[model samples]
Target: MSPARAATSVVDVVAAALRERILDGDLPPGERLVEGALAADHDVARHTVRAALRVLAAERLVVVEPHRGARVAALEAGDVTALYELRTALEVEAAHLALSRHEGRLPPAVHEAAASLAARCRVGDPRWVRVSEAHTDLHAAIVRASGARRIIEAHGALAQETRLFLLRIRPHLGYARLASEHEELVADLERVGPRALRAHLRASAAVLVDQLA
Candidate 1:
């Protein structure tokens, strides 16, 4: 690879690690980020670490201070509400569009993923990370099925924001109602049309908003 390609790869690696820590709450909101420490942890140079932090700062994941340092971004009550609002609109839209696009039945992978979600609920996982992956994939499947470009982008942004709040909430929330909700969503998609799915999605979003409240 060229010099530029190598540099980009290093930056991407640093960025991904930092992003994971941020979303996972290892780097909690208002936590200071020591550049040299992060560089050592990631096995990258300080310059590379700085470059990665800058990208996250631009994403509002971190607050960068010149001559000071960077810290994790905090999500306030209003921020939570805004995130859920966006999630509600885009996810409901995606569900509606995807159901409309489905000619007769759900696609195989989607059906399987939905079934897996049901199974996950029955088992009752205590691990937040495991719960999150299932939640993320289910939403991704719904949005991807729509084949809508801008809607997918919007959903992606909301998912990122949701991850931050989940960092704080997941340990306490557990994986019960969420699992049943997934089963219900799958059943709704199977029985009713997009309209009912949209209603279900909206109600689901409302639950998250209430959680924030």
Candidate 2:
């Protein structure tokens, strides 16, 4: 492989590993990140670790302090609202466009994933945490089907930001509401077409904001 490609691969690998840990609350918000330690853990050089962190910092997943160095991005209410609102707008449009362009049906794997998450949503905090992941993926998959890479990327970052709030606050979004919302979102996507989908997206965003408040 080309040297550039090899470098890119290292960056992507480190970014992804950190992304998963941050999402699942392994790297909780406000937690300090030690670059050398992370390098040792990931078997990468310190420069490679810093490079990966730069990517996340650019994405607003982590914050880089002046002298204190980098830490997981602090979860803030305003930031959470902004991210979720952006996601809702992008996803609503994607849903409406998908319905207008495609013929019918939720992708089977997507449906199955949503179903699996719905069940797990009714369980404990760890289970709820896993379910939150599936929930993000399911919504993101719907956006991806729109065949709009830019929108998908934009919403993808927003999804990551939203996960921060969910983890930091552990908001009272307990099982029933989460499962029911996903089920309703899927059902609405199935029936009433794009309009219902958009409405649901807006409602879901509002619910998130309210929960944070």
Candidate 3:
């Protein structure tokens, strides 16, 4: 109701709209996001647009540079490698914890997530973004199975970046392969433990980095 609160709410709405556009590939990487144009389009003040850009920048979805203004963040090979390195560390550990905690059986949620992803892939023509979302959900489910709050929180932080990276690489990886590989990983996790997950992450990182190159 207050003026300040109202302004903050507008900023959130604007930022969320922009975020969805970027993540959905409607606003491709390197596309400039001019504050003046966005302000006019969204019917908000320039300062509000500026604040919305800041929110996206914090998520690494936008790059705000001096004079050049803001643009959708470009995917770099180095960033891909770095993200996967962190993912390997967090996810592999999560897999270990999950297997140990559940007496070598994965939680039912993991199977459910995998099934959901497989079903999505079975569609006649799957939207890459939807497939990517399902892929992310399956991995998040694996992390959740760990029941380690800190591990879950850490992996959750990477979700957006992971989705972005996956989107870029999905074409190269193929929808069917993505679904099959994850299903295989989940099936083998109990027998092989974290090794399966580490291998999966490392392989994906290699593919993405190669594509970016």
Find the candidate with the highest lDDT and give its number: 3
Model 3 lDDT tens row, 1-213: 999999899999999889878877899999999999999999999999999999988878899999889999988999998998899989999999999999998999999999999999989987766777888899999999999999999898888788888778766777788888988999999888899999888888888788778
lDDT score, residue 1, model 2? 100
Taking the tens digit of each residue's C-alpha lDDT, what string does model 2 give over 1-213?
999999889989999899888877788778888999999999998988999999888778899988898999975557766765676688878877666666755666557777877778866554545766877788877887777888888888676666665665456566777788778878778777666766765565565566557
Candidate 1 lDDT by residue in tens digits, 1-213: 999999999998898888877776677789999999998888889999999988888676888998889989887667766666677778767777777788745566666777666666567444554556667778778788889999987777666556666666654445677777676777777677566665754554455566657
Clashing pairs in 2: none
Please give the ranking of all candidate structures by TM-score, highest first, separated by commas. 3, 1, 2
Models ranked on lDDT: 3, 2, 1
Span of 10 residues, lowest total lDDT, candidate 1: 124-133
Off by over 4 Å in 3: 1-5
Q: Local error of candidate 1 at 116, Å?
A: 4.1
Q: How big is the positional error of residue 157 in model 3, measured in Å on the Cα after superposition?
A: 1.3
TM-score on alpha carbons, each prediction: 0.80, 0.77, 0.91
